[model samples]
Target: MKQPWIHNAKTDWWFILSPPFLVLLIIFVFQKQIQGLENHYSFYTWLFLIVFVDVAHVYSTLFKTYFVKAEVQRRKLLYLGMPVISWCLGIALFQFGALTFWSVLALIAVFHFIRQQYGFMRIYARFEPDNWSKKIDEVAIYTATVFPMLYWFKTPRAFTWFVNNEFDWLKNLPDYIGVITVLYILIVTVWIIKTIVEIIKTKTVNIPKTALITGTYLSWYFGIIYY
Candidate 1:
């Protein structure tokens, strides 16, 4: 017998995605107010971004590392040395210039975001028996996540990864954005249809993978459009 794609129940998967979704939703609802609140309610924004989303999630990796003795022992050098190396590299970059620091950091952050989405797709694909199905899952999630960043690149937006003027290098490239957005939508549509076909045949759906893709689409689209 084969295991289901989602390791947990549908409700559990939803629960996992809800907090970030709600945070994004709150940010979307308060997009305009956030700019004004920068002075008055700056701490709140800091708490939401730095505390809740950023630092909190970084520490969440402890579940895969510190909490797991075997993993910690296996990757001891990585667990121990990465922070020091990252700090030194950060200092070196900042010494170069603020632009260098932020530009590098922003690129790394975007790459991290893309890789994280891809990682989640892999997790959700653990039970997938077919190589083609796994590849489709990979492509769908990556397309959904990456194209929005490309939109941000070619088209200016109010929100940014770090600071203002950091990602303002590209201007008025609507044609590039138009093409990427269409390609993204077409890829997503085909993936959805394929998933539907699989569900109809197998009488089951991969709840976690679907939720991850859906949340990626919602968050990325709204994050770009709203902000």
Candidate 2:
């Protein structure tokens, strides 16, 4: 039995992920026009704009429940602020001409950190043991950090495979039993398996729901890889 508020929240969030309309409009109508110009704007500037727009879309999801009450309003504002601040930092990194891929990776790491931290806080507020939350936090932090670094440095081909499906870098790997790409795939496979097992053991459907949402947003990337 879903709460009415929860139902409304999900409905409102659908607007954020409505790719066929809003996302396509942004990509085609706005970005394509901008790309044709011979302006001084670097690729990083356009990437920053894209990321800011994404943050804005996510922020819009809070409006579904924002006006309900004072407490809810405050929490919604704070929740929205986290991603905004992170995106602002990412924009700063872009201005400094940091590697676009690494900057994006760092932004994702921060986003996941905030989400996992919020989950830990909520669980602790329910009187869960501090040790339990600590363990979860450590695992989440390590996984987030290691995965991004692996993709950025050692297994750039796997990272491309994760995103664009082009594996030109794979041909350059040493023909060894323990190549970095192979190791990265093994690590990610194990992580996914462990995550699914934990979700089942805890009987927590929210974990799977989060995964599904992530998969939905990355569907294009998966399509490129799998197809």
Candidate 3:
């Protein structure tokens, strides 16, 4: 049977599962000190945040695919061809403009991040039967990740994806953020009601899934919208 925690309580809470929330917590507590990092500690910040976290995560994919002989042999053509194809496509994008290239990459990274979080939610909910609630869970997770991105597009802020001004072209739009905010509030309200009803009826809460969803909302909101 599928379990609530991914690995175990300590591992999940400290590392694999709750790291995003913890990172946000650190950001919150160190808000004043963390400011002006770009001016003062650009190299250190880039080394830790971008190289260690982001690039390391991307490179770790190789360990699962290319590093495994069976995985490589199972799909040799795919294993070999995809890297070349990606490189060529990346070159083609760069030929357009640096802004175009980086912007596309940044957006792709955003989508990848969203899907990974959604995957975690699904894994946590694996034991639950298929139902409308599952669909709502999917919607809530997507909205939690997506709304902040959309909000970022309309309103420029301090945070950046890959480089400075990567999102500049997307800023400014019709006054629909208010509408989106209302929809976001509506969705959160519905999710709250759904969770409360589930707890009342079943006398059990899907702890991991709830934590995943709630952490996603808070992290994205603070990382993108609030900051």
For model 1, name the residue pairs that clash: none
Candidate order by decreasing lDDT: 3, 1, 2
User: Model 2: per-residue lDDT, tens digit, 1-227?
Assistant: 22112234555346432442354455545665654541556556545755576456666766665655765766876767877998888777668544554546645754664464345334423433456533543344344334443344333332231235233344466654246446545645555565577667877534323433333324332322222
How far residue 217's Cα lies from its native spot in candidate 2, in Å, is: 10
Runs of candidate 2 with Cα error greater than 4 angstroms are 1-150, 153-183, 212-227
Model 3 C-alpha lDDT per residue in residues 1-227, reported as the tens digit of each score: 34578889787877766777888989989888888776699889989988998789789998999999999999999999998999999999999999999999999998998999899999899889899999999999999999998888887576677888888877655667999999999998899899999989988888888888999999889888887
Q: Which 10 successive residues of model 1 have the least lDDT summed?
A: 1-10
How does residue 42 of candidate 3 score in lDDT? 81
Q: Please give the lDDT score for candidate 1.
A: 0.78
- Spell out the clash pairs found in candidate 2: none
* 1 versus 2: better TM-score goes to: 1
- Model 2's alpha-carbon lDDT is 0.46
Give the Cα error of residue 29 in candidate 1, in Å: 7.7
Distance (Å) between predicted and true CA of 53, model 1? 4.0
